[model samples]
Target: MQTYEIWDSEYRFMTIVWDNAPIGSGALCTLCLQQLGWKKSTVYNAIRKMCEKGLIQNENATVRVLVPREQVQREESDAFLRRTFSGSLPGFLNAFLSGRTLSEKEAEELKKLIDAHRKEG
Candidate 1:
């Protein structure tokens, strides 16, 4: 899998693009200004950077995501969990659920997912 590295600034920029992609560049710039407190230069710089990195494209003043948001998020989550928990899913889950409570529905859904994966494996 060809996962690209996204720095914090780039991630923030890509989030906006992913959320409003296939959007007019002008409208994207306006949204960034309102949501991110970014200047025109900042938005343009991020646009150029992501374009060069193959994360997005600017064609005829329209912005489009070259990589889907789900792919990026999955890659980022896997990388983070591996790095932080030495590739241990239980360790990662323990840390993630620490000091937090899941709703009954969420707990049930998670249990079902675990059971399904276990059966598949």
Candidate 2:
């Protein structure tokens, strides 16, 4: 998969935009200030940078998402899985659940998800 590398701060900024897209740039700045405590300059800077990255678009002083949130999550999750667990899902799950316990309901949900994927693939 091609990398759509986004920094942590940029991801946070995008989260707000995703939550309230087709938003005016000024409205976006206000939300960033209220939620992320970012100034207008900072908001505009991110808008400019992400627009150039094709992650977002800002036209006519309005901002919109080009990349959906789920796509970014998938890309980041895949990268992390490869880099940290050598693309091993079981290895990742083993480490993640080492000191934890799942309730019956949780386990059933996971089983259903895995079963569903197995059927799909």
Candidate 3:
């Protein structure tokens, strides 16, 4: 899988694309203008940069993501956790949950996900 690193500004732009894609490029540009207050040139610049990076595809004036949102999110999340938490998920969770109470449903869902992963691995 191809992974791309997105800076904070670019992530905002990409989030819009991820949320509203397989949309017409013109439509996406319009949304960017309305939602993000971007001009056409700014939107086109971002689109071209992302397209060159293989993060998105613009063909026939239609825009679609080349990389799925989950994949990019996972990669970015993993990188962040590794860098900030020394690659220790338990450590990261401990820090994240410090003085915090998770709801039963949230805990159950997390447990289920962990169990499924364990079983799969």
Q: Which prediction has more favorable lDDT, 1 or 2? A: 2
> Evaluated with lDDT, which candidate comes out highest?
2
Query: With candidate 3 superimposed using the best TM-score fit, by how many Å does residue 90's alpha carbon deviate from the native?
Result: 43
lDDT of 2 by residue, 2-100 (tens): 447787788898999999999999999999999999999999999999999898999899998888876674235454334467768887787787834
**lDDT tens string, model 3, 23-84?**
89899889998889999999999999889878999999998988876666423545433546
Stretches > 4 Å off in candidate 3: 73-121
lDDT of candidate 3 vs native?
Answer: 0.83
Q: Which runs in model 1 stand beyond 4 Å of their true positions?
A: 73-121
TM-score of 2: 0.58
The TM-score values for the models, in the order shown, are 0.58, 0.58, 0.57
Clashes of each: 0, 0, 0
lDDT of each: 0.83, 0.84, 0.83
